[model samples]
Target: MAAADSEQIRRRYDRLAPWFDSLEGILEGLLFRRLRKKLWSQASGGHILEVGVGTGKNFAFYPDGARITGIDFSPKMLEQAQRKRQRKQIAVDLAQMDVQALDYADNSFDTVIASFVFCSVPKPRRGLKELYRVCKPGGQVLLLEHVLSSNRFMDFMMNLLNPLVVKTLGANINRETLKNVQACPFRNVYTDPASSDMIKLIRAIK
Candidate 1:
């Protein structure tokens, strides 16, 4: 069952590989960059491990000389990121890995970043626990996620339509992902506005 869940999601993403860049690449990049500029104070000169680094949209904003290692389940996505390696100043090593079961040693990174990733991770809590485990003590984890709305009307519509939305976007629209991240035995969770009940900036520590 677990394998099926993983495969199904991967297949969905694989199908969307070509269109993915055009659809979410620039628009999401703009949104993420605006928020990241505000959050750079937390991440300046940090070693970064980015999960779900689809197309490497965040690569442009990472400070010069930041050590960045990116991982994603989709091979296609990582390939898209590799295409832009030259223009970047940072040291980047990207790989394909499962978020819930990372292959790195514990406390390996100075900063960890995820954007709109956790909601569809097969196992959200375990993925977060792994993220925390990989991050060094006092190092930070950053996320930008579109989570469930608190308003009953939007929540109801989301609950009804999210399954279909997930097939298209490769993520859930109504997940309480911030709550899940906070519950994952981490510390100092903070969130900023992305939309109504959709947070754009989330930072914390392992």
Candidate 2:
């Protein structure tokens, strides 16, 4: 995708920042939080980076004392995340950065994470490559995402809805993320369905 399109997506998210926390709260309660907690709780130690860390929703789920850096493309979202971090007294480094072009050095983090993020990335593979680049050798990447379904009926529905969804929210509802992960350089990829094969939790070693 072009840089201009990516910027537009960022702006959309920034505009949504004010209501995102509340909106996501209801969505999380429906199912997202359970999977988020399950995946995030596995980062036992070492420096961790969360891509698309909107409002730091998974912040509290990370193990205590873990060194964490959270980045998002949306400044307004990052501001809300900062407020949450301060209010909850969570120690973390927060920055406004794009996942597709991370600023961090190679092999800088022991673990990389992203949740419900790839669907909105203008270039998902590029973003995944960046995730792979920043992760240390032998480190792991954890992701919780909703992807294109294997079920033809559901897949058709998601595909049918994707354009409208993307136009409105800048999030595609039919991303084939597990396939993308398999295509990336990361090894030992594993995925399990979290919600009827629509949402998934993915793990990979770098």
- Score every model by TM-score: 0.89, 0.96
Q: Model 1: runs farther than 4 Å from truth?
A: 29-32, 39-41, 86-90, 193-196
**Overall local distance difference test of candidate 1:** 0.78
Residue by residue across 1-206, what tens digits does model 1's lDDT show? 36677778877777777778677658657675676566554574357888887777677666667777889898877777777665554468989998988999999898888877887788888888999999998888888777888889988999999989877766788888888877977768877654435665788876
Best-fitting candidate, measured by TM-score? 2
TM-score quality measure for candidate 1: 0.89
In order, candidate lDDTs are 0.78, 0.88
Runs in model 2 lying further than 4 Å from the true structure: 193-195
Lowest-scoring 10 consecutive residues by lDDT in candidate 1? 36-45
